[model samples]
Target: MARLRRRPRDPEGRMTLSEHLREFRRRLFIAAAAVIVGAVVAGFYYSEIFDLLTDPFYEYARNNPQVDASINFAEATAALSNLISLSIFVGIIGSSPVWLYQIWAFIVPGLTRKEKRISLAFLGATIPLFLLGCGLAYAILPQSLSILYGLSPSGTSNIQQASMYFSFVTRFILVFGIGFLFPVVLVGLNAIGAMPAARLIKGWRIAVVLIFVFAAVATPTADPFTMFVFALPLTALYFGAWLVCRRLDKRKAANRPDWLDVDDTEASQL
Candidate 1:
């Protein structure tokens, strides 16, 4: 007779150091594969994506004939390099859900089955928030480009290197997307018992200040409107996360065993 195969083990059990490393390696490989697959897909739509990225600059130039703004390739291989770089960036962003899940799974091996399922649901929320942030950044991109270009003297040629422009655009989008994920992080911390809602509520003043600072940096334009717009959603999300955490805390307290909460110094009446 053939030998019976071992049953699948839960990831939460105690493991040797090497086992942990192997698990990490496996997750990393899967995440990398997802990114590669996404990059391959992006390669097929390179032209459309390229045009979409560069359209803002072209539009600005078209609307203002006085400003001689043009994107130029400084090196012989600049175009090819930019294409590869752009593809990799798009891959990283498009496959973020996979990589992000891998990261979460690696750190959360101690989570209970119920907790894992709840956390997975939160992970699903990350994608939409990230994409929403990217969309908002893209919507405001034209104004940012205009603000930067307007600094140059009238009738002067503003020649921008292609690589630099793409780098700026991609970085801007990535930063905004990451910013929108802050609430999810807070909720995750609460879910893991690392942070409580009361603490978050207490630090609201400081958090608001930091959020404003982040919004200012994220929004390239000096105007207050853009900063407020960026900060508002984040502020709302922070409060939302706090509310969720408060509810979770209540549920956790209700489920706790009464004897566990008794004073350690005092004997329990048996």
Candidate 2:
């Protein structure tokens, strides 16, 4: 008996459009489910998380007698809402690896072997960098709170609303965490040949300016010190990425064939 011929496959593996859609849906559902599970787990630790989140403010208040720190719920449902919101945020963060893995799995079949290696490296770097950024933000929270709270008139107590405080803290942490990933993205682009080291090096000045601007904007406080705290590390990371890209470009150039070195003008004339 004759055997049936298999369908042709792309170098990166082949799938129909419908198959891709179904795969995407499956991955999305899994990621969502992971987040939900994380949230449920976090809900049990709501009080602990709340205390941990408020610790920075409390610490600042402790040192400064004039500054009064107390979080109040304005509405009847405000406390419950805050707890749920905090749980969701915590859940997403805690389950990041699961969702991130799902995303990577969904895309891996379409990537070349070398691309897959690079992607795995990126994934490894991303989680640590994000956690580092979050840690930095958490470390700076007390100082930031101190500066902002110090601005209030003497003898006046600062009554922070639970919802507003949580929102601010969440936004602050997320901004820093996401901001730190910018360099990883740059490196990934370079690895994929979408961006060359020369371009990044040439645009260093603009990149520095943008980094500072982003830091300033992302910082909850208007203080220059806080802005610098954010910008300095990010700037360092960007230059570090540039150095890596430069080295990569050199390696590529060394391996390139002489015939491939034709000038752009000469190639166009040909």
Candidate 3:
């Protein structure tokens, strides 16, 4: 039987289990440190994220003549709280690369060569999916705001509190961000062999149902338009993932080692 290649450090040595705990601790510390630094930097730019988010409302208010357009914050403390919250959110998101890298590095020692390659592909696709969702949310914010604003009564339709406005936008961005990653998750499942490309293609009808179900469950707004907007991108992404999986599966079959196929299948099925 042919043997898998070993790294210099490994010298064909397998992990002793105790080393796994030590590595986990080291990666955790690095991830935590990165989070703290990102939080501080994002806190410094808190006003920017705030304004960047709230700019649509400001624009709509400034241009509109009939609605007496302005957001009214009821409490002084709300603004401060919003800043702190926004900073923390930005920090975590901004630090994702650092934390993600730390985690990948820590786990690399335990992974086989093929697993390492799939992990790298997953990391590559993750950023784009997340960004796609965030951009979609930003693009749709104006429409959402218009709908929300138009529903007001005769004389009293101002945003009475910053909390209300922030809550609305933040929820939209977050929901969209997570929702966009649906395709990536599906691709990862295929890469890991828990799901096969052929089976997923066969189950497209059920998959469509699941897509809507995810959109409905994940979306914070009950508005059908907003919910549909979220679902549509995910649907497109799902199809794109199928293409990627098809190519990847063909490559895997072409490159698969026959010796590992038999026993490994039984182990995995177990």
Q: Best-fitting candidate, measured by TM-score?
A: 2
Mind giving the per-residue lDDT tens digits that candidate 1 earns over 1-270?
A: 999986566666656787689989999999999999998888888898899999988888987888778999999999889888888999999999899899878866767888878788788989999999999888888877777787787668878999989988898888779899999899888988999999999999999999999999876567676688789889999999999899999999999888888898998765
Candidate 3 lDDT, 1-270, residue by residue in tens = 999874346743356677668778889999998888888898888878878988888777766767777666677787788777777778777888888788778777778887889898888778777877888998988777776676778797675477777787878888898888888888889888877789878988888889888888877666677878887877788888899889889999999776566764365432
Q: In lDDT terms, how accurate is model 2?
A: 0.90
What lDDT does the true structure give each of the candidates?
Answer: 0.87, 0.90, 0.80
Alpha-carbon TM-score of each model against the true structure: 0.86, 0.91, 0.84
Hey, what RMSD does candidate 3 come out at? 6.8
Candidate 1 Cα misplacement greater than 4 A, ranges: 1-12, 107-109, 218-226, 257-270
Model 3 bad stretches (over 4 Å): 1-18, 256-270
lDDT of 3: 0.80
Clashing pairs in 1: none
Instruction: Count the clashes in each prediction.
Output: 0, 0, 1
